[model samples]
Target: MLGTVEERVQSCPECGEEIRTDHRFVPWCAACDWNVDPGEPEEPGGRLEALRRRLAREHGERLLAEVTTDEALRPRRDAASVLALALASAVHGFTVALFVGGVLLVVLGWGGALPVLGALCLPIAWLLRPRFSRLPEDEQVLYRSDAPELFALIDEIGGAVGTTGVHAVAVNGETNASVSTYGLRRRRLLTIGLGLWEMLTAGQRIALLGHELGHYAGGDTRHGLVIGNALGSLRTWLYLLSRIESPTAPEAVLNAFYLLPRGAVLGAAMALDHLTLRATQRGEYLADSFAARCGSTEAAVGLMDALMVSGSADVTLLRESNALRGHRGAAGEAESGLWDRLAAHTESIPASEYERQRRRGALRGHSVDSTHPPTHLRRSRLLAVAALPAAVTVDAARGSAVRTELSGARKLVARRILNGG
Candidate 1:
């Protein structure tokens, strides 16, 4: 400073351009026009938050307009088109037949042996077909007989959401809940996270259950699985193809030729996936709307707030669980200790920090690959809907029993995680 030192140059994290500035502070990149200053902390609820709020408000307005004008959230025809196209592309029968024809032509000496070589390549590619499987054995499953109170609540929520009974319920060691279809008949399986369940109130729990069951009520379970599986298959195939190698020059040329058509197919499949994703986004809003209607709007909103807070709460709980690995407590005592640690950690989080977390959540946006809409958008959509009374409620006694049952499951999951299972 005594000699008026020159400013240092640094690489911009965003654009990878060299940032040169004479100023001692507030450095910025000219290439991408992004701030390159590493010293400055980001402002709380900055421009991104403002932009997200505006967008959410506008989206909410449009949704309300559509509800008033169209009478319902109309199904997207583009999604159906995408599903059809994906199904058609997945059928490789014609390509197989062409490979067979090429083999025949080469066998009869109608052309060079290249056709037979290409036909042989088809079998290699077929052998490399991506295999898909579902694994639920690792998760802790709970039967209705095991947790009757929890089952009763699920039944109540299912009834309110106009769905048949869930096939089974499982405890997932996370801060979220999901409903998925399994097996040939597509039986609905519900997975509830103990971390989340522990933090929610009875009303919030009803909203949570209704929200997941609402996916089934909206036909999302079946259609979403189909589109998701198709897209996953397309992505996996592309990844496998990209991993394929050619050691020789001729093989490299052949591989190049093969990839040309394959790339085009993958591109088209990606476009369809994009369209399907849009429909899925709409489905998420619809599910939120359903949840708000089935439970009180306040409860639904509270559940979302809980989701934002649960992330931090879950991390804190997991850290505490890790510290209890070598403890020689009895089974029930160990479980109680885990819950006690979780509660203390959760309560220790200050109100201001929780508010900050909520603000951060509001600014968070979903990527194209994400299945759900952003938290802020979901909140806005629910706020736009008319308020409704809660469809179901659990008495304190029943709620306590349900929580006790969940605690047992939570202890099992915690033990497994801490034991590095």
Candidate 2:
């Protein structure tokens, strides 16, 4: 998604309808009532107290692992959903063409050939769209922009967590993040929202990114993307069928004959999507665990607060601003084309308005088929994961220890060079 040029001043997060700024970065929005920056550390309370507060703040809407990553969840992407979409699309197209041809055939008294031709065309088109439409790695990278700082951090975290290199990272406008894998080699993509950056404290943002990368560490991205695309095809087919009744007319009759079967194809596709979704949700917890293991549980807490603050703040502003204009927010805006628009709405609402719809309860949690899980669930899961035991903490003591290790290593190297040993 393209970023809008800073224009048309609106209410500030701290003071509404008074001042506007081009900068998207913010630690807190006082006027809008949100919190993105990491909160001040709580006083030394018991471990349980910290955990309790985190849970109370989150309200139990967390993502949990529902399958084994190495087995059940890994194979989903390349299996059938992609093919199903292809098949459904071909059928839909052929059915339409046949309907058109049938009309001509009826006029010409050539009824026998019309249905046969339609059947042949329908499945072929359905199969081809997905085959041709597979996203290249570079295109996936373009979905969100990345910065060098973030990349360095990912590299550090990957080493700490003992994973292969971080795959892909991008920025969207929403207060969200996700991980996905599409095939056998097990490469993964990690995405974060621009709003997430605007809302989170530096430490918290690191924790959040680490959590997404954790999905890769746990092995999800290689299969998830492919499955998602396949299920998407199913959704498209079923959705079209659900909208029609008859094929008597060019649009109607073709829809009637092709859509119903395609919808069935989607049902299976949706099931696959669900499996991936469930596994991904679980993968979130593993990433969280990794982040906590890296000595940043407080960062996890800060991430949650940032999500709540950013989400509430962004929505309050966007909704009110959109309300003044008397139109649905960007989500309601028409797409560039049918396929593009359908894919946009299907994939996820644009980042520009995700928090707004999410806040208003307009978006369903499970019913959604996007790379990221819902914001609320993400926040809660982070909090819950923060409660897990950790191997280290991001404290002054830890910093000193690392410094000591480096100093000792430097001294030993210097002596070796000096003594010519």
Candidate 3:
């Protein structure tokens, strides 16, 4: 255990204001935010950054206006959506054609018709085969039977929105949570990150789940079989033709030969991404609406606020994980207070800090990531919607049981973090 903590006063170099900082908390001028995010003082690439922000901000604003007026985020067969599907179909057809051609040539070659041609085509066809997502063989997964209380909550939330139910839940040590599909059946999988989950309120947790599961109801075109697989195939091609950062003489020749095809694939990928951009963004907003409906508007808004502060959570987690790893390095066994310390640190954060993070998000025109609308806009839209009480709730007893069920997952994740594997 450490000694009694005391507050320290320091002058803010930029704003020249006295700031009180504690060892337990990150110190920065609440007034000017000096020394906070020093490395990322500004967004990189002056003019390009400005243009990107300007364009993104304008696009976000326009989308906000459209949604405000429409507010109907159902799957629509719009022109762009149709075009994307057509492109995806064409891409898939090309792959199938390659496969058929390769197999036919191989058969002919075996029959002593065209052996060399058959041999070359067979390799090409095999390489161009349709790729499918597979569940990671090593990643840990929790079935409903393993955690009934948690699955109950998840089921309730799914019913509140509109999902059959997730196939399983996977826990990770990252600062984000997401839902994914696996296999030909497209079995739903929910992965909740401890770093973000620990920082949330019970209600915010519901909102997070609602938002994720909402994607199923929201018709995320990018995740559809046609568009998604096509995008995957294009990515595979790009990967195969990708240039080496440093190349020897023969490798240089290969790179030069691959350049044109690489450029074409890159351009196609960009275009496909653009085609699905609006639909995906719409899906995200609708998901937020689902969050509001299931977890209440306030909880949904709070979840968005929590997302903005995830960077701070990430930084603190890095510090804590490094310290924890160092402790393990020095001792035979180390006590794990990783989650406890993270929760405490987040709880200790002042409202002022969250407000500052929100302001920074607005200035940066930040979305959850590059794929969604700006955070501020999302919050605004959530507020604009009619308020509703939570459709699903986890009482203290159930919540406790849920946590207990997650104990094993916590150990696995903590091991993953400290070991840095």
Candidate 4:
């Protein structure tokens, strides 16, 4: 009896075909017609199908709530931010003083000290800076109370698109989303805000997610991370030092004394930042195309419209909220002024709609919960993508029960992953 039981466990349940335990970690029981780790609890009406439906519903709600609520998606590292600032500040102060003093010394007959001081600061800057720290894991950075379904979606799309599974999905209350890679192994992170979830249509959401995944799959995120970190350090150092030194110094004197080496750093940093930002924007366009090929166009359009509406709505909400709270910031006021000036220059939207959008856009400063290009711009880009002929199309006639089952199962897992399971 013991020998028979062991044999049964190893055999395929359906055809009695030997259940090949492939070393690649794929546990497919051909006889039983099942995967080894069929993720999620099975439900009736075909367990995987039912799970997919549940996930879709949950994903919709999460999108809505994430945008409307005030929740911290990632842990705030005051210490890290402070350390970064201090690193820049310290380097700037020392460099400025050295350059100025060196020039003054050269004029005062003490030139040899300049080279010694310059040599010393270079090593100190390298030593004092932080080492590569892995960003907090996906689970730690995000909170997903209703994550099962989003995980399901990610699995479905990522599998079809040949991208790594999403490592994290998070929402801050803003009309934006971003994907990033950090550290040695370059783990991928998928970040969405409450604003984005609530604002985009389901199809649009998928498209956006696809775009983020494209970055992960294409290795753009990792490149961006390295460039961003390197440029950020140099930018900070240069900006701080430039501010500390007086501008009245002659251009030749300034470059020779304070600017020559630092200017090179500044230029390089600017180029990196610009390139990184441009790459992200371009990734959005490709993802738009990717999602269109894989899924429903209606869903894609819905996502874009949702984003636009929500963004317009949030601006109005913010202005009112700020007034109610009786808080006014200089930068916020300046931003509002800029918007007002732009609004004046543009063709007028309807009064009611205009007021509504203004209120939503007014919610705090750009730094608060804002990132990404404005909704109108993104919407225009999506529409352009939609106009393109799709590279691949799903064949309804060829779709099999097995394929449906696979899609359903994948969806469930992706949703769970996204929701932070």
C-alpha lDDT of residue 107 in model 1: 70
Q: Count residue pairs with overlapping backbones in model 2.
A: 28
lDDT of 1: 0.63
Tens-digit lDDT track of model 1 for 1-421 = 0123266688888889887654423456656656422233333253323433444444544544554344355344554655655563553444455456656755765567776676665664454333333438878888788888888888878888777768788886678898886776677789988777767777887888888888887666225544555555555555555634645888787677777767765665545544454455666766766677667889998787777677666665656556566774643465556655555555554444444444444444442114556675567566666777887877889978987887767778767655544
Clashing pairs in 3: none
lDDT for residue 75 in candidate 1, whole number 0-100: 42
Candidate No. with top TM-score: 3
Query: For model 4, what is the alpha-carbon lDDT of residue 220?
Result: 50
**Candidate 2 lDDT by residue in tens digits, 188-228:** 55655443544444456557666666666676632443444
**Top candidate by lDDT:** 3
After superposition, which runs of candidate 3 have C-alpha atoms over 4 Å from their true positions? 1-37, 41-58, 110-118, 243-259, 325-336, 366-368
- Ranking under TM-score, best-scoring first? 3, 1, 2, 4
Per-residue accuracy of model 3 over 215-257 as CA lDDT, tens digit each: 8877778877789878888878787888888899999999999
Cα displacement (Å) at residue 291, model 4: 3.5
For model 2, the superposed segments whose C-alpha errors exceed 4 Å read 1-149, 167-169, 179-190, 221-226, 239-242, 245-263, 315-421
**Per-prediction TM-score to the true structure, in the order listed:** 0.70, 0.46, 0.84, 0.46
Better of 1 and 3 by lDDT: 3
Decoy 2 TM-score against native: 0.46
Error of 2 at 263 (Å): 5.1
Clash count list over all predictions: 0, 28, 0, 46
TM-score of structure candidate 1: 0.70
